[model samples]
Target: MKPRSRPTLARRLASGLATLVVLAGVAVANRPMVAVAGEALHTYQINRESYKKRYGHWARLPVPHDFRVNAIHAALLHTGKVLIIAGSGNNRDAFEEKSFRTVLFDPGTEEFTEVPTPTDVFCAGHTFLPNGNLLVAGGTKSYEVLEADVEHAAGVMKIKNESPDHGDRVFDKGTRLRSPAGLIYLTRTRVTVPAARKVTHGAHIMVHAGAAEVWVDAEQKGDGAVVQDPAQYTIDGLTGDDAKNLYGVADKITREKQEYGGDRTSYEFDPVAERYVRTGNMRDHRWYPTLIGLTNGEVLAVSGLDQFGRILPGRNERYLPGERRWVRAPELKRYFPTYPSLHMMADGQVFYSGSNAGYGSDTEGRTPGVWDVERNRFRAVPGLRDPRMTETSSSVLLAPAQDQKVMILGGGEIGESPVSTARTDIVDLDERQPRYRPGPDLPKPARYLSTVLLPDDTVFTTGGSSGYRGGAYRGEPRSDLFNSQIYRPAENAFATAADSTVGRNYHSEAILLPDGRVITLGGDPLYDETGKNAGTFEQRIEVFSPPYLFRGTRPTMAGGPTEISRDETASFATPDAARITSARLIRPSSVTHVTDTDQRSVAVDVVPAAGGVEITVPKRAGLVPSGWYMLFLIDDRGVPSVARWVRVR
Candidate 1:
């Protein structure tokens, strides 16, 4: 009865299809869909060829030497090479060894040449001058130590023992001293003890003398002994933690005062010679300042820690390129957070987008607003959500600088906080009342992101972390985000690009090369695969080729003017002039810490000429600040040619 009837082939097939349909339904039901504001967000279609075409390809370049100098700062020089500044390499031992470093990386040759750094330029701010020189200001002098020193007058009660030139002595802990002496004694009493004495039993002493408190074993040194002169007891020896504390304190103080005073030492690095020449020092010492090129061509140096490690006073300074000196801009009585992201507006005023590289508090210039440098006033611009998430964030002046729109993206809370945000917002400064409006959200939350304005009027963003700066805190070793995306303003959308092989986080940089490829290098992910701290100094370099590069043969620039005047038609030879669709002038980047305000792309009207195309450079200084730019000719297909260097004067 059980084998009475065997099912037909068609019946068996129907049963299998039913099972498949049931499993498919279950999988679909369980699939998670991302939502924004209770509304399901649509994942835009990723055209692999289109993605590969637009985002380009990435290739890792071999590091020339085992350069331990982590690229904490990087800039694209007019000479076509990237300047990498490491400064002390972020290692205390390296800093003590005077291992401060800088490197010149030639993208064309894929070679690296070591450059000499006169001082510890670590954590400095820099921008490109009109003449194409990079003006680097502020840097680490010396890191503060945990232990400190104090002087006190304590009576040396007796010389308990003597051995040749060295001797052991006792001091009276209860001895009463004078005003200043008592102040020191009271402050250091419980924390430390007199590790060294200025005088021995035989030496003369005033009623009171100086003493230094240090960590030492009180049981071994014993108490004070009566003596005619406490000054006579010379400190010839120390032991245990006292020796360690004294050595550490002395080393820090010495370096802080002597070798690490570069906060006030400003310099201009001549790209041609690849050497840093001394420039006029700033009015105040700066350790993490933001140097922004104003529309007038002068550089405004704002914020930074002073020599004493306090936020620099509200009095900022302006660097006169002609005078090569920094003058106090007392009239511009505004302060900003360290590495504040500032963009020049059409009216010659500067806008702080509330994005900083992790320094300064809300009261001390962390507010977002448009600053009138002339009138010395800040007009607050509302609508930026999560002000606390601005640290390590990035901002960019949308393409065709004439639009006068700025965008801010991706940041997190300061000081090793694990929280990050993918929030992006844009504001139109040209509007009567400018305020930020929500822009496209990032694929994921990130910090330390580098945004590059492309020739095709698109913004290419890459390299960041989901954690704090470089994901160094909270055991986030794999926090580096290799995914890259391109923001198209025309559609107000973000298109995903190819993922990079290297994890670039804190102390990393990405700059657009003259040939249109992007060179990304350096990173410190807290630790490397070797389980050694050495990997934190990421030295490898990777180049990303965008989709346009894969398109048909690139257009060629036969001949073009090396320099052009504002509002004038500039003619350049192009075989595909008839096919040429757009012309752009991209300012070379001098970027660091996601605070590159100088890099902007200006769209120019192009018309076909006899054998080339005639393009007009914008007359507005704010639209196209006078500087060397990489000029590109794009065909109708959006394929850009190798850029020709042009000076917009």
Candidate 2:
């Protein structure tokens, strides 16, 4: 080839500049076009019947502007309506203004109704009762005050009354207490101290002092009034005899970061009345507690931060459904981290799967174990992979509760650490010496993953972040995952599902509805897409329809008794009776923070009758707790029918 003469510097510069300008123009023109084309292709692929048949489909529900509140908790009622509770929704301003919210959504009609929320039930624990009522107990009493924002030293003070003649004494808020050094502190809330009691013990009269605790803040600002040792203080306003009898005691007071306080108020949501009914207060204030309904029709409340922002130190209580009251259960004392994933096993023991949402010491109360309530004993299970990363993880009672298998999924390091793991492990509680075994790893490291069990004996998991509160990870600005999968226990594998349109992380929940669909809501990310500004709580809701829904027409069940006792057989009319292979009674989900002890599936033995099918309820009350359940019949093809409301007595 003929060698061209080298261009002059000016000529080369002009040519290079011209080429640069042309390339820049092309780049700018293709950016928007490429995004549009890619989105179009994704939409086409996901909408295709073949794709939807293999995987599932996700769609966003239209929520009215006024009805849209931050969904901090969700439960599916027996009436097929959803109860969504926000209760300030982690908004400090809203909590201060008392702008709590609760709404009811009817999935059948897609209608919304606002309900009056009496208190801040945010971060509270809830479970379904035998009568189909939801027992909601303990919530946010006070928001956290970071060390940088704390203005004064504070501590809990116990007031004692030693005079048997005096009646109960009520001290209003801001009551002052003076220490020996003349330092003063004010009570943060009103408190009532009972009168002293005289008891006869072996022919002797013993007078016992009555006491009550209240939070107190130093009267003076800064740390000058901080006390490091146990001390007694005199009541500010009292007579000569009263002053001696009524005294305050405290261990220590310091200018430290104040964690979120728990509330003692409790309520039972009456599904039929569509209102909240006040119940007796819990024995202990609790935030991030877990309330699991026991086989005896009572609820066991465990693991929460107290009103003074201290973990309750294993003290637990129980709710009496008959009297609508909570009583201290001193015999069943067991400690656990806040929001522990506790499930009641078939043998009536609670299995703690080592998954906790946060707010406890990393070294304490994080062991996977089986707790015997009657005997006050715990047996730890070994061989959990990445055990230190159990915070913000999820655990589920594998489908067909009879199998007694539990699986713990993805989690991150304690506190707000950015580290996460894709680890998954399973343990069979039925084994004599059950130990955790390795399972398939997740596609990526994740936290706050929502796992739901379906009637088809498969678990559907979706929506999590690879970082804390959906923050930045690796080189990405945000780590909210859209991918989903279906875990088949029979096959011991996972199949890919459709991606979610919205992100779900901390404070989010996924509930299995009566019609065999899962509705997912709520995500409180630490940062927005840019990872630079505070993220807004996600108010949008999404629904996922599994592949079974798109397979073919589902079996139909009709005309069943409203109540059936254990060991009793009930007949239900169904046109597809011959094709039905099995039946399941699935308890509805009342979930928050990815911890749901109420959701479980009990297999029912079914036999084809003359014109319908008869299902024999299991005789074991521990396997199937007394409560309302959605009865679903699954055909041979693995498709389940629309659930029929049934109550097991």
What 10-residue stretch in candidate 1 is worst by lDDT? 248-257
Off by over 4 Å in 1: 1-51, 66-68, 146-179, 183-262, 470-477, 527-535
lDDT agreement of model 1 with the native: 0.74
Error of 1 at 491 (Å): 1.2
lDDT of each: 0.74, 0.93
Report residue 70 deviation for candidate 2 (angstroms).
Answer: 1.2
* Residues 162-219, model 2: lDDT tens digits: 9999799999999999989999999999999999999999999999999999999999
TM-score of each: 0.76, 0.93
Give candidates' CA RMSD values in order. Answer: 13.4, 9.3
Deviation in Å, model 1, residue 216 alpha carbon: 20
Indicate which candidate wins on TM-score: 2
The parts of candidate 2 lying over 4 Å away from their true place are 1-30, 197-207
TM-score result, candidate 2:
0.93
